[model samples]
Target: MDPKTLLQNFINGLSLGSLYALIAIGYTMVYGILRLINFAHGDIFMMAVYFALFFVTLAQLPWYLAAILAVACAALLGFTVDRIAYKPIRNAPRISALITAIGVSFFLESLAVVVFSGIPRSFRTIFPQSLNEMIIIGGEMEVKYGREVIVGGIRFPVISLITLIVAAIALVFLWWFIFKTKVGMAMRAVSLDIQTTSLMGVNVDRVIGMTFALGSALAGIGGILWAIRYPQVWPYMGFIPGMKAFVAAVFGGIGSVPGAVLGGLILGITEVMMVGIMPGAAGYRDAFAFFILIIVLSIKPSGLLGRPEIVKV
Candidate 1:
């Protein structure tokens, strides 16, 4: 491939990886605290975009306002899902919670189909048309993607730049929240030992709910950015991407935030580069993630950044 195409594909890979990192971070956070896989997470990602669709299309709200509402709705949905589905069984066998997560996933997907229908919805009106314009490096001049753009160090799609910047900002906020704030400390305490933390008078259930909310909010950002990049939404659209994000989380280390980001970048870059190199195998691109998962599990089950669990007798 030519230098320009290679550069463009690398940038696309980073954009795609950024989305995966955003979503995968949610998976890691929840698992860090609850040890529950929360299979409905991808469905939650789907629901968030649908929420945006209604707010933007039906409510006729501005895109920025709609995005805010969508993220808030997603956080609310995350809290509600825990209370309604996962909370009651919080102390149940791990397998029961696992099955319930799967059930919840199915429920959300069906509800979306019934409410939003199976047809795909386009969001051409939502994203600013300027996002399609390219920003050439070494200068502030911008031009449309197909134009004779030059005088460059690198060319970046505005949407890709936005996605990368947003993901970085959101993740940084999350890190600060997890480390610096009292509530974040409470979250970490709970992750360490729920019973001990509760013994100290912390509201355990509330913290768990908040953890879910935080993770889901990140997924909301991811979903919105995803809709921006893909510009279309459907009931079951999140399954593959969600699963890919999950693989990213696992491949990086399910309980490690940085691991998820690393795994996502590696996976995304590899997938895009592979497609660029051999267009024929594009059909099997999805298989790459699972293959990595299998390799990781067989070779290093604890993952790159993960610590092996220790059971107390």
Candidate 2:
């Protein structure tokens, strides 16, 4: 492949990987604290897309405002889900909680179908149109793949740059939130030992709720960006991406934020490279995550960044 084609694919992988990373972070956070998969997370992401769709299309709000509102609503919904669905079963058996999570996931998907209908909806985003525009500068930028982008001899899409920047910013903020703030400390404490943290006067329930909210908010961000990139919305839209993000979380080391990001980028690049290198295998794109999952589990169940569990009988 030519350098321009390689660069384009590279950017595509980064963009997709960034989304996976964002969504995977949510999965890791919830599992880290509660040890629950929270299968409904993807559906929550689906809801965020609808939320943004309505905020922009029906409510006639600007895209940026819609995004903020969508994230806020997602956070609220996540908090509510934790309070109503998961909270009651907190002390129950782990299997019970897992079943509840699956049920919640189904409920969200069903609710979306009923409310939004099964048909896909399309919408526009506020992303700069100039992103797709070609600009010529010194050295006569190289363009390939018909609509390929080039600036200062570097071949990459504008959307790719935006996605990378957004991912970086989100990770940095999350790092600060997890390591610096008191709430962050409480979250870590709860994750380490909930009973002890509760005894120490930390509101365990509150911390859990905040974790759900934070994760859901990040999911919301991922959802909004996804809609902007793909410009389509449907009830089942989150299923595949959700699974991919889960794979990323596991691949990177569940419960580790940085790991989620790493896994996401790796998964994204691998998938993109696979398709780019073997276009005939594009039909198998969805299978890539499961394949990676199986390999990762077989080699290191703890994942690349995750610490192995120690059990005492």
Candidate 3:
């Protein structure tokens, strides 16, 4: 491959990887706190994209406003799902909760089909036409010019810049909340021992709800960004990304925030590189990701950054 082509592919990989990381963080955060798989999360992310699309088409709203509304709708939907489906089974057996999650996932998908219909919807270009122009970089490589710059000939996409900025801001706030704030302390305490935290006068139910909301909101942002990049929307659009994000969470160690981000970037870049290196590899892209998942699990079941769980009998 030419140096310019290689540089462009790497930039694409980073942009794709960042989106995966954002969605994966949602999975990791929910699992970290509640140990629930949240099968409905992918659909929730999908719904956010649809929500933004609806606003853009029907209300004729600008991209920024549509995105904000989509995030709000996603957070609300996630909160409602927790209240209606998961909350009642909080104290039930683990199997029961898992079953409930599956049911909820199916219900959400079904509702989407009924409401949005099974047909695919394409999104209008969110960015202005002027922003779509290409610029020559390093006097040889051509890169898209927009609101962001390719750093020192690195050829990073403008969208990647936005994703990194949003992810960084979210991570910094989350770190502060988890380590510095009173609610953060309460959340950690509940994660450690819900019963004990309740006994200590913490509102366990509220904390769990907030956790779900926060995670879902992140997924919402990821979903809208995804729509912007791909510009396609369908009822089942979330399936692959959702599963991959879950794998990323597992690969990085389920409960670790940094781990999820790292895992996402690794998975995204590896998949992109596999296609670039092998001409026929694109056909097996989905399988390749799963194969990597299996290998990772076999070598390190707790995940690359996961802490080993200790059991006492």
Cα lDDT tens digits for candidate 2, 1-313: 8787787788899899999999999999998888889899999999998998888778988767888999999999999999999999999998999999999999999999999999998856755445455644457445323223466566665556667888788788889999999999999998888899999999999999999999999899888888777888999999999999999999999988889999999999999999999999999989988999999989998899997861111
* Native-referenced Cα lDDT, model 3: 0.81
Give candidate 2's error at residue 3 in angstroms: 3.0
Candidates' lDDT values, in order?
A: 0.87, 0.87, 0.81
lDDT (tens digit, per residue) of candidate 1 on 1-313: 9998899889889989989998998888888888889899999999999999899888989889999999999999999999999999999998999999999999999999999899998965466655444545456644455312344565566677778888989989989999999999999899889999999999999999999999899999999889878888998988998999999998898888899999899889889999999999999999988998899988988788887881111
**Candidates arranged by TM-score, highest first:** 2, 1, 3
Model 3 residue 147 lDDT score: 47
Clashes of each: 0, 0, 0
Q: Candidate 1: minimum summed lDDT over ten consecutive residues — where?
A: 142-151
Question: What TM-score would candidate 3 get against the native?
Answer: 0.90
Stretches of candidate 3 exceeding 4 Å from the true structure: 1-4, 136-156, 310-313
- Show where candidate 1 strays beyond 4 Å: 132-154, 310-313
**Candidate 3: clashing residue pairs, number:** 0
User: Against the hidden reference, what TM-scores do the models get?
Assistant: 0.93, 0.93, 0.90
Shift in Å, residue 14, candidate 3? 2.2
